[model samples]
Target: MEEKKSNGLAIASLVLGILSIVIFIFLSFIGLSWIGLILGIVGIVLSVMAKKKNPTGMATAGLVLSIIGTVLCAMALIACIACVGALGQTAETTRDILTTIY
Candidate 1:
């Protein structure tokens, strides 16, 4: 039987997964939500590739973390968008009020 050799893809997946978590944390603290989104996507791709090459517990963990990162990033994105929209509405309302008063 031929033995399969482990490749760097697995390592890459692990590194990317860790990076995704770090990026998520940084974004959460600093309000740079887009960085988390990008890192999560990259982590997910690396994890999937690693799993395809060789199934391992690390790869599985990477996959789970990648999914969580992606979801959190997406939620942040939605919240940011909603906040901006609300701000715009509020600004317009304030403008209307000022014009009416003037």
Candidate 2:
């Protein structure tokens, strides 16, 4: 009889990594970017752990995707925060007029 090994963690990591990218792109506009960022971080950790246990192409790809997703989500979050912070700062007259007109 042959023994079978499970790749559950690697699979989960891949799933979460892909979801992180998808969510970061589609749901970030609605303030769900944090969720994606969290997912990416979790995926990265899982993928790393999975690699240590049983390195696989899926695990490697998962780690890469998770990193990309994390970066994108972090950038979005930072940009949103900066925009909000800037809202409290003084605005030029022309820019303010344009903003108010919208």
Candidate 3:
């Protein structure tokens, strides 16, 4: 009887995908979303290759999770940037108002 070997890339993709999501959820706000985003992208590429070589549940999960993590990380990063920009603008406006009143 021949046994089928599981794909390693698929496993790595799954782990990386999960890690990406965890990082996004826990550490995304501290300018660390890039790590998760990169991991997700790499996982996605690995998962696609793994699917072509040996399609499995792990590969599918990895692909889906990687996509989701990537999107969330991107969104978080954009939100953080926008928030910073807004804070800066608000600070400048407040300073201007205070200066004018004094």
The candidate with the higher lDDT, 1 or 3, is 3
Question: lDDT per residue, candidate 3, 26-93, as tens digits?
Answer: 99868799999999999999889888888889889989999999999888876432344544567676
At residue 97, candidate 3 shows an lDDT of 68
* Order of quality (lDDT): 3, 2, 1
Q: Each prediction's TM-score against the native? A: 0.62, 0.70, 0.70
Query: By lDDT, who's the top model here?
Result: 3
Comparing 1 and 3 by TM-score, which wins? 3
Evaluate candidate 2 by giving its C-alpha RMSD to the native, one decimal: 6.9
Clashing pairs in 3: none
Could you tell me how far off, in angstroms, the CA of residue 20 lies in candidate 3 after the best superposition? 0.5
lDDT of each: 0.69, 0.81, 0.84
Candidate 2 on 1-102: residue-level lDDT in tens?
A: 111122677788888899999999899989798999999999999888888888889889889999998889988887432254445655575487567655
Residue pairs in steric clash, candidate 1?
none
List runs of model 3 lying over 4 Å from the truth: 1-6, 79-102
Better of 2 and 3 by lDDT: 3
What TM-score would candidate 3 get against the native?
A: 0.70
Please identify which of the two predictions, 1 or 2, would achieve the higher TM-score against the true structure. 2
